[model samples]
Target: MSATATTTVTATDSPRKGRSGARPLHLPGGISLRVERRALAVGVLLTAAALALAVVLIGTGDFPIAPWDVVQTLLGNGTPANDFIVNDLRLPRVLVALLVGAALGMAGGVFQSVSRNPLGSPDLLGFGYGSAVGALVVIILFKGGATEVAVGALAGGLLAGVAVYLLAYKQGIQGYRLVLVGIGASAILIAVIQYLITKAQMIEATRAMVWLTGSLAGRDWAQVWPLLAVCAVLFPLVLGQGRALRMMEMGDDAAHAVGVRVERTRMLLMLAAILLTTAASAAAGPISFVALAAPQLARRLTRSPGGNLLTGALMGSVLLMVSDLASQRAFGADQLPVGVVTGLVGGIYLLWLLVTERRAGRI
Candidate 1:
């Protein structure tokens, strides 16, 4: 049975009025949402920034279309050459980056919220490596096509998630235990990936290496559509669970007293997070630390508690698009994979997190 069936709200006093710039939106069945004005403004700004970066990426590639022409082409009013560059050549990769980043950001937010730990990201939790192993197996052993690789990645991620959950489950799940177990699992999976690479032929090994580096160089519409569809479906489902997730953050006993099925909700949320991670990994080859960094960055930007899914998604889109641009343009005539930039940045952030957490006596 679902928790919502028995969910009931009891108020001992009158509802407090909202603060300035916070509006109360009443919903069906007496539920209400207090929308924050500042957060909304931040989301809008981040979205515009993401769009601006997208335009820059589309216009500044090898062929170099004008920004105005990129805009006009998007609106169906540009020259055929510009249209081909913007729509056919560049836009698909940019879109893939945007969508993959958003998916990772949301997945990170979900895991972080559930674990109540800043380090509980897909990359840290072995899910990314698990997906990598699956993709590598398909690429090296089976010589599978793109769609088969995607399916393999998804299966690998889900299996990894389940393994972590079961290994961490003693009397329910503990955040630290889950993290530790996940790290161990991730180490094992990475060893497997290394062995697989060592055994592959030169051409297959090179292809696997490039994919594992997480490049957006040759992505096209085929990569974009399936990821877009997955994000479109899964994002809303996760967002809908935001309230329950927030409730769970108050601790299991407290949340249970208020009609939340803590275990079930956590399981569902973990499943959703794994699916989102799987989708992004399948599309972008486990681009590291966007998941770890984006949600934390978005929370800082919004100054809000809980997941801040909207801001996180927007921030992720901006981070990845900017990273992709830097990877391509930072070195003269030497294009780098997008993952290289994120890995370097995310490593610094992780070190900072470790020091901060240690200082706070939370690790």
Candidate 2:
């Protein structure tokens, strides 16, 4: 009943195990471990690629520094000018982009696994719309600063998620029901956001519009620190329940039969992923498609089942970093927000996804 239900064997035959070459390595104290070699390899490669992209991003800004210089600056061994450019200026923005992407990727994986659907993402869960509502409310009505807007978005996203959880709880929540309720809530939240925009002054409306695009611009240590702190806590918390989550993906009855405590694990994953998604949205204004696409991409790349949190996290970071690079250098002198780049790519990806789903008769 595991995600890798590739083969079945009866008691008269041999012990049941996946065809994934997942042999148990007996440790001292008779502890055996099952590691999916391909998946782990994929995760390692992704981490390397993400780091390489991060270095490229840090080094290729307006005041360009060589990759070596960027590394040296990070190590406190570069000249003051290079140090300022790499450490003081570009590093925070790059970190924010990487962290936000990783958070979104992991959260998306959790949601998708929980719902047993590829489209199960923060936006589909209404968290992104809810966060947008909070941010727009601050931008339009309160005339708030960047920090205030972020705080508002976080609060709004959490509230929206709570509401969806509550509404979907008919004795207990089902994955499809949760997604449906969240979609309904998202529609309402989208309307609220539009209304807020209509009521704003021209300047406020413009500000709101830009934020809605989900950029990583003007980011500094201030944004990076808190997001890092949140990811630090929530990432492990989510990963710790990965086994239970995979079991739940099989089905509630099967999971319960295996002592999986399906409901509690589901609740834990949902809450953790909510915090992760909201934190990422608040940090970078809901950069489109990372949550929706990262997990699926990682799954495909690894050719593995279940959440694949670590691989997704790395893929998300790399995807966001590449988009940020495209925004900064691909266009002419005029700078583009990272969100615009992501949106364009995400749109195409979503179309492809829809077509695939339709062909598969899963839509």
The sequence of per-residue lDDT tens digits that candidate 1 reaches over residues 92-134 is: 9999999999999888888888888999999989999989999
lDDT of 2 by residue, 1-363 (tens): 112221210001123335664455556765545556566677778888888888999998667888888788898999989888888888999999999999999999989988888888986889999999999988898999989999999999899988988899886668788889888998999899889988999999999999999998889999999999999998777777777777777788888997887777788889999998889989999788888999899888766678878778888898999999999889979779998998899889999999999999998
Cα distance off (Å), candidate 2, residue 348: 1.0
> For model 1, what is the C-alpha lDDT against the true structure?
0.83
lDDT per model, in order?
0.83, 0.83
What TM-score does prediction 2 earn?
A: 0.93
Badly placed stretches (over 4 Å) of model 1 are 1-21, 26-31
- Backbone clash pairs for candidate 1 read none
Q: Return the TM-score for candidate 1, rounded to 2 decimals.
A: 0.93
TM-scores of all predicted structures:
0.93, 0.93
Q: Candidate 1: lDDT of 78?
A: 89
